[model samples]
Target: MKVKLYMATKSAKQQASIIGLLFAIVCFMSCQRSSNNLGVTENMEKDKTDVAEKIVLTDEEWKRRLTPEQYRILRQKGTERAFTNEMKHLGKGSFVCAGCESELFVSDTKYDSGCGWPSFYDTVDKNNITQELDSSFSMKRIEVLCSRCGGHLGHIFNDGPQPTGLRYCINGGAIKFQKDDEDNK
Candidate 1:
């Protein structure tokens, strides 16, 4: 009877150790994520841009304005496959919303985040974009949108370089790049 009791205690101890190890791992990952969030704006306050400038279009009008791929990503919240977009190599330009042509990001803020999509550390104007808490796909994320047209540009992650620590993982199809005049020459 004593031998049986000893074995049961040993098994319980092993189970406790495993649980402890798992908890430690989860804590470590959470810390990593949170640390990267430094410099990111916690409160997504609306910028005092002119609401009158907002472009409200019918579904059919949007369909006509944007390409099919752009329509999918911007209007339907779809993601493009990584590293396949031409925007990755673009230089000296401004990225505008595909739906409303609103200036969103500048080429100076663009960086290669190795995330496949175009990553920007900042926007040309903070008032041009909006963010929402997206709890889709069993994960929590900040979804970035074009404030004027309400188009889904992409998701913004805290895991980015300094200054803002924001990686705007935008779908290439969701934006149109206008080359700077100097760049064109």
Candidate 2:
């Protein structure tokens, strides 16, 4: 009976070790996967102009420049309620950074992602934006920021349409649309 009890204990220890090994393997494999899709390197240097011309403002200055909602999303990294942006249907303009008036996205890239916020497949210029690994709220995501002002625009995801399977899920409050002349006509 003692022998059987000892064998049972040994088997339990082996099971625990196997479970631990499996957990470690999963974590290691996940870490191997690249979190960024746009090829923004983990240590990529910002452009000289982007660095030199960056918009730096104090909280009071930002408050003065942006609307309350814009201040929340751009400066505070807060999110607007999904589908709440009035500019979603503007259809023909470039979206500029609310904080710095830097063009961040064009209307041509806009699409209905049904994620409740404005979604774009591409940016007006790659140099206008930057990305960072976001691990907030117990989830891992790629956070998109305005390179000119370092403001939080949104998060990018791998699921998107052809040409570039990346979704720049931006907050509308962080941007202002300027209608093109053709759109005005």
Please give, for residues 1-185, the per-residue lDDT of candidate 1 as tens digits. Answer: 99999999999999999998886565333323433343457667655667799898888998998889988999999877666789866778899998889999999899987667788989888889988777675556677899998999987878778888778878889999999999888
Instruction: Give candidate 2's error at residue 5 in angstroms.
Output: 60
TM-score of candidate 1 against the unseen true structure = 0.76
Q: lDDT of candidate 1? A: 0.81
Q: What is the lDDT of residue 105 in candidate 1?
A: 93
Please tell me which predicted candidate would have the highest TM-score against the true structure.
1
- The best candidate by lDDT is 1
CA lDDT of every candidate:
0.81, 0.79
Q: Over 4 Å off in model 2, which ranges?
A: 1-49
State the displacement of the C-alpha of residue 21, model 2, in Å, after optimal TM-score superposition.
37
